[model samples]
Target: MTKLLITLLSFCFIQCQGQTKKNETDEEKKTRQEAIIKEHVYDCADKIHYTTQMYEYQKCLDEGIKKDSTIAYLWQQKAMPYYKARKYSVGKPFLDKAVQYDEKRWLSYRAFMKCIFSKDYKGVIEDFETCIKKYGNSYEMDHTYSFYIGLSYLQLNEFEKAAKIFKQDIEEQSQRLGEGHFLDLFYYGISKYEQQKWEEAIVQFDKSLQQYPEFSDAEFYKAICLMRMGKKEEASLLLVKAKKDVEKGYTINEDNAIYETYPYKVRW
Candidate 1:
């Protein structure tokens, strides 16, 4: 541990020791100590964000990990820059350690990275399935666990499974949050499009567009569906609009889309 961390922890111990109450219960004392440690960890973490140098950042995380090897956030912090830089192989070991320390918190995030950054669709499916079994259909990075599973199945060309999972996710979200996310609806449409179910795909694409007006991927795919159904004139008009919207930067706006292309995100 660094001298600064050592000193801060020592000061916290001394301060907490001085605050002990005569009638304090064992659980109360434990809670108090945990709070002090958490605050000290946050204080150490605050300094990490001020530096952009990778070595310095990793060094800071190393110090915190040394102080408490059980804290998963330190390991995750150490791994993020590597993944963001497309160095997934270099980052995976650190991320695995984070998962080891806190599976519930970091497993879904690791699955998300595997889905988007590493292109490990099988691994993504396995990790997300594990997450769903343990946590029961949760959200990670703004999408449901099933959403990533659906995306992974799409990448693996398992369109039927992808569409099934997407439909379940849409229904669950509709019941829980009043509506499904636009990307969920859009990707469901892509699954239908892949299956060449033109009319069914068009219905999903239209619903997605209702949620996100001028969503280029939905518009583009809907136009393709129209053309497939022999509505050539209407398809041509919508295709032109889709191309113009995409040109104006109206594409997948997910935060990680800045780092990697999402599955089926239209570029043209």
Candidate 2:
């Protein structure tokens, strides 16, 4: 009876192995077919559509999905053309599906940025956290994810938490960029500004100016801090410099004038 039971278990294991092999074969075939469908879709869009509208892209995707719904990369690729064309609303749904099918880290980043563009800060925060979990921590990681997370929280009016996170991000950036990175100073200044730490913001703006003397935004913020601190004369001079530099096209960026309480023709 024991020998019979052992024989029965061996047969079941062999059957399961056979079924696994068959599943693997089918999966491989599906992958190959999806590749063919993606190539055809690209070709079809190129031949048939002069404008890569979302509907046209969706048609191509439908064709690919009909061939192999499991092809997540095909969905991702379909979204790419629309994203490149700046049809974000059209691409966003497909990108969401692509994540559902395959949650790759880079794709998560793409989705996070898409959500940011879409003004879905909550979704952006979630995706950014997922990215950090999958990709681990690093300089770009801290600057990109943590900074954005703090921004999202600030936008959502979680100021205390946002301030703490932003400070942590600035600290991480200082460690990574040796406290002298211009962008690091920008972020630090912005973080302090968000927290209403005008004095600290001024110090950070100064650091930024020391690194890049013509840093327009830093100068603008310094003027703002001066205005907040009731030093109108100094603020006015800085604002004048900002306006002159801007009018001369020495600083074409609109942020300097707009943020400095100076009138500008262009608003960003």
Candidate 3:
């Protein structure tokens, strides 16, 4: 960790020295600053660890970014430590630059950082909607984008809106992902369950369990649907199977509702 810290410090020193170029144009100066900021950011990123030294290293990158404020990716680099620490309060302001500059190939995957880490579901939906409205269909090509939006709506108890998006994705895909992602089906099932459509929710859960056989949560949800619809025997059997899965330590999305808590694991 000490070596990594020294390496990043040395990189910053080198950049400060190099920026003293003679008779550089204004644009050239900006470009040079951007390059220097990126250098320090990458150096810090490479050295990141769960250590105090690494936090100091990241703070070094953040300072460089703040000093060279025009560079979008620099701000993103500033946010790296916060993202890793699940500290969205400190990170989101920095990530704002990546969004503003449209250097967002990775940011597209990460809007959920706000939803999962900040409990900012409404903000997530509004931001995605605004961006998607501006960028249109191309902005939402990734399945995860749709999932996050729908899941946020679910969190808000807005079942109809959530169902609209999930149904579109599930029904419109060109090819099946064999059984498909369990969370995809799970969220869709949840939308139905929230709407009190017991039979439909059970069908979705059944399809999920068919593909993701060991998904205890899916079985548990299915049991709930059956129990709701007065199929006590069937519900009891499914609940027993789900209990065994829990005892054997299976896990899935929508388990503890921590994403609603404004602090979360980076992944769903």
Candidate 4:
């Protein structure tokens, strides 16, 4: 009985020793990976600061994320370069991880906004839906989210979806600033134009002009829509007027409105 007890004790000791060694090896591997991740992250960030070449920096950060999922900020940082580089496919994944960790909501939103500029309409819709669910009530959040949602749908050729949101935006603006607001009409006209609802677009532009007559770009787009609707005479008149205004230094580069926010100047 004594010999049997000694054997049992010996077996238990061996098993425990093996378990400890395995655990230690796993921890050592994890630590090594973390160190590697940290080095790559710093290198990438430095490169981004110096060169502004986001694609190369993003490559380094992507490797870091694969090794150490704990570094949430790395994911967000990784996305910036991809976004600026116009690599939406690569950027979306990292930004997706950043949001997954729940550490950088605002950064994630900004990254997603950049994704919209890359013309990733599906990504914009997916990310915005989550953002609205997560932070719907904040005014900034609502405006930013809704605007992107509408913009994304517009890009995706989902005009009906954009039109619905623009309609809601108009109603919201009306309640806040009262009716006949130029901004409300302009945005509504934008939505109508996206939908190829040319007549409605013309009406909205006319309403905007009623409030802000010097909105020459609105006049230009209105003319384009009128031309699309086979109203060549009306379009010609508006074009002549727009050309005169441009010569008078009165025309606005409708595309330049959001130059600061968007990396690329939106042509339409």
Worst ten in a row by lDDT for model 3: 259-268
Q: For residues 19-124, write the lDDT of model 1, one tens digit per residue.
A: 7654579787557545544654465545565236677667666766654576677778778889988889999999999899889999999999999999999999
Candidate 3: pairs in clash: none
Per-residue lDDT of model 4, residues 165-262, tens digit only: 86776676667668634654666687788768888988888988888786766788898898998999999998888777656655433332233233
Using lDDT as the yardstick, the better of models 2 and 3 is: 3
Best by lDDT: 1
- TM-score per candidate: 0.83, 0.66, 0.72, 0.58
Rank order by TM-score, top first?
1, 3, 2, 4
Over the full model, what C-alpha lDDT does candidate 2 score relative to the true structure? 0.65
Candidate 4, superposed: residue stretches over 4 Å from native? 1-71, 103-111, 137-143, 177-187, 194-196, 207-217, 228-234, 240-268
3 or 4, greater by lDDT:
3
RMSD of 3: 9.0
Against the unseen true structure, what C-alpha lDDT does each candidate score?
0.87, 0.65, 0.68, 0.65
Q: How far is candidate 1 from the true structure (C-alpha RMSD, Å)?
A: 6.5
**TM accuracy, model 1:** 0.83
Task: Write model 2 residue lDDT over 121-189, tens digit each, in one string.
Answer: 787678778777877543233345776676667667676776677667667767766664555466567
In model 2, pairs of residues that clash are none
What's the lDDT of the predicted structure labeled candidate 4? 0.65
